[model samples]
Target: MGTFQIEGGHQLKGSIQPQGAKNEALQILCAVLLTPEKVVIDNIPDIVDVNKLINILSNLGVKIQKLGKGKYSFKSDALQLEYLESEQFKKEGGGLRGSIMIVGPLLARFGKGYIPRPGGDKIGRRRLDTHFEGMIKLGAKFRYNKEERFYGVEAPEGLKGTFMLLDEASVTGTANIVMAAVMAEGETTIYNAACEPYLQQLCKMLNKMGAKISGIGSNMLKIEGVKALNGCEHSVLPDMIEIGSWIGLAAMTKSEITIKNVSWEDLGLIPATFRKLGITVEKRGDDIFIPAHTEGYEIETFIDGSFMTISDAPWPGFTPDLLSIVLVVATQAKGEVLIHQKMFESRLFFVDKLIDMGAKIILCDPHRATVIGHNFKSTLKATTMTSPDIRAGISLLIAALSAKGTSTIHNIEQIDRGYENIDERLRAIGAKIIRTA
Candidate 1:
């Protein structure tokens, strides 16, 4: 395990570029399996999860070449289908949630898909029913091995497109179904699909590769199956979650930082959510400039004079990924706000760590917490803590950076799973953080 020792109470200043969207990259990377031609992807973040997916691809006999930094070419001309049934594949594919996405494309192209129970952040019960049920709707025979904890799908008669109203708008599930439908026979209509920028970009990229998809930014998507998909080039958008995390860090530590090339149009409701907490965000071209909060910031109450509630929903709503950062920032805001993490029950439990750092927080339930801002009146006392997940790890890092004295955070590998070179990037902008093994 690695640890980060952060010396807090420093004002960071400078500009940093956000890594390419990790979520989008996962979907895009998995999309490469839809075609046998070379798919060149740019702006791919150098993170652990992405690298693991790439390694899985390589293990499956997909030809991979690193063109440059954040650039790669993948050609699945000789995919080893037998690898999917191998114990080695089980070990590799079971390590990351993104690995589950390969099932859709593999089933679409090769008539079979197999996956062990995938793992990711232990935030909530992320069921795979949406993914499997969506595929089954498209005429695939689904089977599960209870003893092995494995899922298998096969469409020997080939997939035929059909209309499906998903039980919920699951991002990965939607991406999986779309990839499977792209090569199926006839037209497929997906209602209540996830419309996040990640899925939007996936659709756009698929279209570039000869798939006909409509409704780029809406909850409903129409796909006209194509005989084949060719390779195409794609560049991922900036990581909005990381962008929001930087904003929260700047606010809590009173730092002035500029996040470059953020694709402002795609960051729906993210900036506004931070603004509700009284953070100043200026848009200069494609960049979001966050000025230092020297005069302190206040949380805005609802018009009805009730505590402002920050919650998560599907796209166009405050992302559940960044709610931890918002909760941390609220610990230093001038007023109290309720954080309702609707998506994940255990996500808000991290508030206990923040409370231990001398912040006033009330954990109302597994999914709700009320944060009363300390307003810089009581400086956070640095202490040792273990990071629980990706977003929570970064939130704790932000809290550590804003606290008085030094703080030690173990289990930093959780942070590295998503954020690319986080310690190096933050250090360039005056954050006093060191990574030690």
Candidate 2:
């Protein structure tokens, strides 16, 4: 296992660039399978989960070439369709949650797609029902192998588009269904569709590939199915989650940090959400400049004088991914805030480590925690902990950076699955973090 040994109590300076969206990369890379022409993608984040998906594409016989840093050219002119049935494929595909997305394009183009149970952060129940159900609504047959925990979708006679009201606006589920429906016969209408920037980029890219899709940034999408799609160049947006993490890090460590090229227009509720916690998120020409919180920030209560409650919801609300960072930043603020992580039950479980470091936090339940800010009256004392998931790992790292002593974090691979060269990037900005194998 890899580890990060960090010396706390350092103030970071200089500007750092946010990496390309990891979630978007997974969806965009899979769309290459929809066409046989060359699809060139730029700004691909160098992260573990994305690299695993790229490897899976390679194993499935997509010709890939690295043109430059974060740039690749892919051609799916010839693919090894039988690889989907191999044991090697099953084991490889199961290692990544993003692998579930590949099935959609494969089914649309090759008439069949199969995958064993996929794995990722052990946060909660991340069911595949939404993904498979969307495809099934488009006239695909679904099968599950109970013994192997495998899922399959087949549409040998081609898919026919139809209207679907998604059970939930699951981002990946909406993305998978859209990829499959792009080439189906007639039209496909999806209501309650996820309109996160990740999905928006995918839809735009599909449109560039000659697929007719509308309702770019809304809860409903209309698609006029085309017979086929062509390859197109696409670039990913900067990861908003990482951008939010840096904002939290700056607040916790009293550091002045500038996040560059953030594509401000697409950051729907992120900046305003952080400002509600009393963090200063200044918008400066598409760059976010977070000044050092030399004076510790205060939590803003409701107009009626109740404690502030920060919660997650579908897009246009606070993202569930950044709730962990918000919870950590709240620990050092001047007032109390209730963190309701409604999406994942166990994401709030990491607060115990912060409590051990002398932060005041009350774990209300599996999905909620109340954090009482120390207001910098007491400095946290660092200790050892293990990373449970990507967001929690980064939150703990931010805590350790603002603490009083040295700290060690094990299982940093979870952190690497999202953030690219996190230790190196943080070090460049004056953070005392080292990665040891």
Candidate 3:
């Protein structure tokens, strides 16, 4: 396991460009399986999870070529369908949750698709019901091997479109179902679908590829089945979660950092969410400039005199992925804030690591945490810790950078799964962070 050795209490300067959205890249990469023509994707983040998906696609006989940094062209004209049942496929495809998406496209184009239960962050119970149920609604037969813990879907007569309402608005589930619906026999209407920017991007890309999709950026999505889809070039948006992390990092360490080329309109409540924590998120054209908080930031209170609560919800609301960053930044704020992470159960457990470093935090439950800021009057003492997940790992890194003395973080592979060249990127902005194997 590699570790990060960070020298704390150093202010970072200069600007950093956020990498392409990891969430979007995962969906777009899977969409490549829907077409036989050449699909050229730009702004692909060179991270572990995305790379794993690409390698899986390559192993399945998709011809891939590197165009440039963060650019790749993929053609799925030929595919090894037998690979789906191989031991190699079982091991590689089960490594990440994104692999589950390939099943939708494969089942759409081919007669069958099989996959081992996918693995990802052990944050909580992430069931595959939504993905499978949506497929079943589209006239696909679903089967599960309880002994092997494997799942498969088959559309022997090909998929037929139907109207269905999802049990929940799941991003990956929505993306998977959308990919399947684009090749169904008739019109498919999905109600309560996730309208995240990344999902919207996937729909637009499919539209460009000859799929008729409407009701974008809304809860209802309408898809008309196409005989076949062609390839197209698409660029991913900057990762909003990473951008939010940088904003929280700047405020926590009292740094002046500018994030370039952030799609401001697509950010939806992220910038405003950070501002609620007393951090200044200034918009200079398309970029976000966060000034140094020399005097520390103060959390806003409710008008009724209740404590400020930051909670995650569906789109247009604050994203749950950045709640960890908000919780970490609130440690040094002028007031207290309650962080409610509704999406995942075990994500808030990592706050205990911050509490060990001299921060005042109350773990109210598995879903909520109360953070009392030291207001910079007290600096966190450096300590050794382990990363639990991608978001929590970055949050801990931000805490380590703002703490006193030096800190060591084990299992940095989790951080690497999301952020591309994070240590080098931080170094460019004057942060004293080193990666040691």
- Clash count per candidate: 0, 0, 0
TM-score of 1: 0.99
Q: Write the per-residue lDDT of candidate 2 for residues 292-343, one digit (tens) a residue.
A: 9999999999999999999999998889999999999998999999999998
For each candidate, give its TM-score against the true structure. 0.99, 0.99, 0.99
Specify the poorest-scoring 10-residue window by lDDT in model 2: 343-352
* Tens digits of per-residue lDDT for model 1, 1-437: 99999999999999999999999999999999999999999999999999999999999999999999999999999999999999998899999999999999999998899999999999989999999999999999999999988999999989999999999999999999999999999999999999999999999999999999998899999999999999999999999999999999999999999999999999999999999999999999999999989988999989999989999999988789999999999999999999999998888877788889999999999989999998899988899999999999999999999999999999999999999999999999999999999
List the global CA lDDT of all models.
0.95, 0.94, 0.95
Range of the 10 consecutive residues with the lowest summed lDDT in candidate 1:
345-354
Superior candidate under lDDT, 2 versus 3: 3
Poorly placed runs, candidate 1 (over 4 Å): none
What TM-score, to 2 decimals, does candidate 3 have? 0.99
Candidate 3: stretches off by over 4 Å:
none
Error of 2 at 339 (Å): 0.4
RMSD per model, one decimal? 0.6, 0.7, 0.6
Worst 10 residues of 3 by lDDT: 104-113
Superposed Cα deviation of residue 388, candidate 3 (Å): 0.7
